[model samples]
Target: MGEAIHNVIIGNGSAGNGAAITLRERDPDCRITIITMGSLPFYNRYDLPRVFRGCYDWREILVHPLSYYDDHSITLRRNSRVTDVDARSRTITFAHNEVMHYDRLLVCAGGQGYLPEELSDYRGLMSGFGSFEAAMTTYKALPAGGTLVMLGGDMIGLDLARTLIDTGYRVVLLTNEYTFWPHRIAEDERDGFIQALGHMGIEVVDGVHPVAVEEGEAGKPARRVIFDDGGDVQGDVVMPSYGLVPTAEFMLGSGVDIERGLLVDPMLHTTDKNIWAAGDVCQIWSAEDNAYRFYYGWNNVRLMGEMAARNVTGANEAFEGLEDERLRIDKKGHIASPFWEH
Candidate 1:
């Protein structure tokens, strides 16, 4: 028999894990290695906000335990960051200066939280509500009964705000948009959401932009958010809830096509036949639109990962993307939208 194919997956998020599991089930003899900068094993990122609110601990949110890797014969390398990729050579370099070769590579590095230009320099001062570690940091930094000035008003931000409020932290949410989920919710729904937030004792500010972040005194870190309107809000902990930006910096000059994200065909194959991409780090080619478009949400990402794995394993399956199902959380913290709506 020929040499066993070594599949290297650069991520440990939903997409990466999904791909790994699927690949293992499909090709038992293939070698698989999953790398991640995070120290923890694969966990439910959807429950990260709950982690911040004390609704779930780190162990509780983990999707699979450490033994899952051993049981499946999958190598899981945590705290290892991929620094560069050599597509021509089919090699990837890690932050520790180690290099590894792969017969097939999956770029599921996912996305990083997008901080505004003004707050970029002040990243150390604020907490992020994105990753599991970020949630833990936010939870630890939040003072009892103190104010939390949250930047951004996206769906994730709204959910985080509700969690904080329920956990007894006074929250001040800042958003440049006129309404939450402008592309998804109607104007009346937006107004109702704002009203609901007020009733929950959460402060919501719309149509405002943060121009700068000011450092705090006495080791309190950055506590002030300066607005474009010349107003400011002080908080014990400042958290940013901005959306994600594709984490494909390592693919630069690696022969992988990247525009906002790593470009992938309908089958999720990259320009390099040996390379594939999925999850938030990939932009799928939409045949109908004749352009690359982002497919957000957990279900879409998981499906993309599965498709990428299938294609990598010699299965010719085209990813048509998710249907009209939308997942929305109501004011009561329940999933109001049905699964079929997505």
Candidate 2:
């Protein structure tokens, strides 16, 4: 017998976990390792907002416990951020300058919250809902009935806004070009969403562009979003939710084709034969549209991981995206999307 193949997956989100489990099931004896920047195991990112509801217990959101990976003989390298990828040498470089080699590699690092250029300098003042730690920080910062100003509301932040409002927190939504991102809508749809947000008891402020952010006055803890038109919105905490940008910075200079995201074929195979990519970190080539497109949503991302794992394990499976993730606004101005659901 020859040496068993080593498979390395970068990410611990739905896509990475899904791929890890599938790879083990398909190729029993193959060496499997998952590298994640986060310390905890796979957790439902959608449920991260539950922290604001006073559920700081991470166990409630975790998909599987630590023993699950151990029982399956899968290595979980937590807090390991990949800094570089050498496609030719088949090595992954970590931030600590440690390097490791893999026979097969899959990139599913996912995306990060996009902060607008205007508010870039004030990133330290704002809280985020992207990760467990960020959510907890935001939760701790707020007092009873504390106001939260969403600089730009994306679907994720909007979902969190609803929870914040119901939990006795004031939410001011400042709409911008990136609102309801990953899903582009018509003017009517946008109007419908704005109306719906108003009915949901959120203060929807539109037509203003944010230019900068400022800390609150002495003896008063708050964040102020300064607008281009000399207007501003003040709140206890300001969270920027412009949207997400692919977390593919490490893939740059790695000899893989990248455009907004790592470009991959229907098989999830990158330009390099030894590597594959999935989830929000990749833009799949859509032959029908003759362009590379990104598919979002929980189910879609998980399926992408599974398909990529299969292909990595010697199965030539082509990924047909799982969800029709288009945003829909009804006559009643109710917004509907799989992302808003479990």
Number of the predicted model whose TM-score against the real structure is largest: 2
lDDT of 1 at 342: 24
Q: Return the lDDT, model 2, position 251.
A: 94
Whole-model lDDT, model 2: 0.88
- Cα distance off (Å), candidate 2, residue 159: 1.0
Q: Name the regions of candidate 2 deviating beyond 4 angstroms.
A: 219-221, 330-333
For all predicted structures, in order, the TM-scores are 0.89, 0.96
TM-score, candidate 2, is: 0.96
What is the C-alpha lDDT profile of model 2 across 1-342, one tens digit per residue? 998899999998989999999999999999999999998888999888888776889988999976999999999999999999999999999998899999999999999998867568888888888889889988989888999999778888888888898888999999977778878787766787788878878899999888888999876657788888898888899999988889999999999999989999999999999999999999999988798988887888999999999999889978887556777765656566667766
Candidate 1 at residue 173, lDDT?
82
